[model samples]
Target: MNTYRKTFKFDAEFPFEYKYRDATSAQFELPNHVHDWYEFVYIYSGRGTFFIDHSFYDAEAGDIYLIPGNTIHHSYPVEDDPKRATAFYFSAAFVHDTSSVGEPFHYLQPFETAQSKQSFRFTVPEAYRNQIVDLIEQIHHEYSEEKVGYRQVIRMHIQHILLLLNRHAEETWGESLLRHQAAALPQWIEQTLSYIDSHLEEELGLAIFARNSAVTPAHFSRVFKRLTGMNVTEYVTAKRVMRAKEMLRLNDRNIAQIAEACGFGSIPHFHRKFKALTGMTPAQYKHSL
Candidate 1:
C-alpha cells in the first residue's frame, strides 16, 4: 500500500544522484515503484532478488543492472546476507547534453536495449570488473566532495562507465548470459498495458477495462494496484503525460494541441498533471528543451 511514484529534486545544473548502501535490510526493503530517472546499480557484495519490469533476477556480487526511466522495480535482500550496493541516477538530459557529434557512442544504447528486451542485469568480464568499480567509486567521491570542477569530473566518470557497459553489451549480444527470461505477467494486465500504450488518445477508464476482463470494477481496481504498484487512473495519467512529452520534443505543436492529442480533458488539467509529475508546466518543459 505504500507503493507510489518517487521523485527527486535533482540539481538543475547537474542532474545526477549517487548512493551507497552498506547493508540492505528489512526496514530498507522498497516496494514496487517507478521513477523518472535512469538508474545504474552495482552490487558490491551479498545477494538479493531484483524485480525489474516483469522479471526477477538473482543478484550477487559484481552484478550490475541498468534501469530505464519510468520502469517498475524493487529489490529483496536475503535476510542473512543482505546486499551492499551502489546506485547512480541521472536524467536523460544529462546524457544528451554531454554527448558530442561523431563520437560513435550512444551512451543510452545499453539502457534502451535492456528496456526493449526486458533484461537489465549483466556482468562485465572478470578482468574489467575492478576497473568499473573504481570508476563508480571515483564518481561517488567527486559527487560527495563537490569541489571545483567536480561536476565535469563526475560527468566524465559516468560517461566512461556507460561507454564500458555499452561495449560489453555489443560484444555479448545474443549470448545466453545477456538474455535472462523474464517472468510472464498476467494475460489481462499485459494486454491492458499494451492497449494503453497504443490507444492513449482514447478514453481510458477502470470500468471499461474491468468489463473487458470480465471482473467487477472494484475487484479490477484492487488487483491492478497490487500488480502494477499504481492505480488505473494514475497509470493512465502518467502514460498520457509521457506521450505529451514525446510530442513536445519531436514537433513544434502548441501545448493545447499536444494536450488534446494526448487525450487530456483540458489545457489546465494537462498543465496540472504535467507539473505534478515533472515539476514543470508543459510550456516550461518545452522551453527547457
Candidate 2:
C-alpha cells in the first residue's frame, strides 16, 4: 500500500469556510457529527464539556483541541453564559499525510479506538491562558488581515496551536491530563502518532516509521508500543481495513478502486485483508453498509 491520501486543495484565494466564536457568560452546544476532514478548535472563557463518541470532558478557557478526520464529537456548556472559542475545519489531507520529511501537523495519532467513544477532560494553565489569548489573536489577525500570505500564515498559526498544546498540555491538563493526553504522546511523538492515522495507506512497517521519525527502528517500536499500548503493525493494519469499510459506504466506486484508494496494494490483497479484519468479504461488508 502507498500509505498516503491524495492531498486536498483548499480554496486559497478565499477560504472554504471561516468563522470566529466568542462568548462572555456560558454557552456551548454541539450535536454529534463525524467530519470527513479536519477541525481545529480553541476556547477562551467559560467552562464546558466535550463529548467524543462516549467520553465527556470538562472544558474551560485557553483549551485547544484538534479533531482529526472522520471523528464523531459534540459539545455542551458546563453552565449557560457565553463561552468564547474559535474553530477551523477543512479536509484532513489538506495538510501533509506524508513526504520525504514527515506527516503534516494536524495528523495526530487517533485517540484509542476502544477509547474513542469516551471523553477526557484537560487541565488549563494560567500562563498558557494568556498564550491562548495570543494564539487566538494571531489566528484572528490572519483571518482579518487577509494579507498577501494570510492563507499560509493561518496554517502556521494552526501548527503553533498544537505546539503550544505539546508544551503546556501536561501543566494545563491539571485534572484531565492523565485521562486525556496520556504519557505516550509527550509532544513530538504525539504528532508522530497522528501522522500514522493520516497516512494509513502506506505500508507502515516499523522500520519505515522509525526512519521517518529519525529514531532507530527498534527504539521507535518499543517507545510507540509503550505509549500507545499497541505495537506499530497492529495499529496501522486495523485503521486501514476499518477505514475501507467507511469508504465502502459511499458506494460509488467498485471494489478495485475502493481497495486502491484505501491503500491496499491490490484487489485480491485487499480482499484477503478485508476478510481477515472483518471476517467477511468486501462485498458482504458493502451490503451491510
TM-score: which candidate is best? 1
Poorest 10 consecutive residues of model 2 by lDDT?
A: 106-115
Residue 1 of model 1, lDDT score: 41
Task: Kindly provide the TM-score of model 2 when superposed on the true structure, using C-alpha atoms.
Answer: 0.49
For model 1, how does the per-residue alpha-carbon lDDT over 198-245 read when each residue is reduced to its tens digit? 788899999889988888999889877766666888878877877887
Per-model C-alpha RMSD: 3.8, 14.0
Q: lDDT values of the candidates?
A: 0.79, 0.58
| Model 2 lDDT per residue over 1-289, tens place | 1112213345754333434875533222433444445666667677766644323456666566656554445565655545667777765344433643653333333222123523233344667556756876887887788889877776666556555555554344434332463342445466566676678676667877777788888888787654443467655655677578778876688888888777788888889877765667999978864
Give the Å shift of residue 128 in candidate 2: 4.0
**Which candidate wins on lDDT?**
1
Return model 1's CA RMSD, one decimal. 3.8
Clashes per candidate, residues 3 or more apart or on different chains: 0, 21
